[model samples]
Target: MAHVGVVGPSSADQRELDDAESLGQGLAQRGHVVVCGGLGGVMAAVSRGAAQSGGVVVGLLPGTDRSAANPHVTVTIPTGLGELRNALLVRSCDVVVSVGGSWGTLSEVALAVRTGVPVVALRGWPLPGDPAMHAVDSVGEALRTVDALVRTDD
Candidate 1:
């Protein structure tokens, strides 16, 4: 199983949050680890989902204080780089699942593409020139796409 990074806004619509949470639970149910920015919104929701599913959750925190991570985070990595930690989060993951569009989430998608990492966008950024980043409509579709990409890369 690979580490999957879930990226999105700290504050988001209820639909996106629900999708992120479902994605986390699905990923965990399959034995994959969930990774996030470690604060709130999508991060907290995904972490909570993974934790609830009895899966491991890692939070790549932007601040120096580990306590800033959401309660669902099983492992907290305090980077102290704030948003710049986005690059590290993307690089550390084998695949990235973006839940909603935010500047931070967009940056993670861009970095994942640049680094040749697979990114399954779930209603995320509409960046030009990367057809691979098209947003999947459901959690099942996203997981299928991620599974295909990981198996292909392997």
Candidate 2:
């Protein structure tokens, strides 16, 4: 299965969290693994959505304590690197999905683009002026872009 990293605000409004959850559910339903920062807000919501869909969710946590991880996370990797853990999250995925705007999310998008990894932005995320950066308005379009970038063998 393709591994899609979801980057967004850890503390977001309800609407943003809802959007992230929807995108996560869509990705999981399509048989993709969801990865996130494993904190709260968008990350927790996305993990919850993906797990509810019976998909594997990996969380690259920023702190040493895995207890801080959300309940939806299936696998927790405690980096203890704080924001520097963002690079691991970006590199570990086949495609990156940005749900809401935040500095951390923006860093992931930039790193993904710089590393030649495909990125699908849902509800408008900053692009790095790269052709691999896809700005999709809906979750469906984001899913389509992800599928196109990371083809499934089965």
| Residue lDDT tens for model 1, 64-136 | 9999999999999999998889998998888999987877788889888888887899877666767556568
Q: Count the backbone clashes (under 3 Å) in each candidate.
A: 0, 0
| Residue range 1-154, candidate 2, lDDT tens digits | 7889998888898877888888889889988989999999899999999998998999999999999999999999989999899998998989999986877788888888889888888875555567878898877787888888887423
Q: After superposition, how far is residue 5 of candidate 2 from its true place, in Å?
A: 0.3
Worst 10 residues of 2 by lDDT: 123-132
Candidate 1, run of 10 with poorest lDDT: 125-134
TM-score of each: 0.95, 0.93
Judged by whole-model lDDT over C-alpha atoms, candidate 2 comes out at 0.87
Query: Scored by CA lDDT, what does every candidate get?
Result: 0.87, 0.87
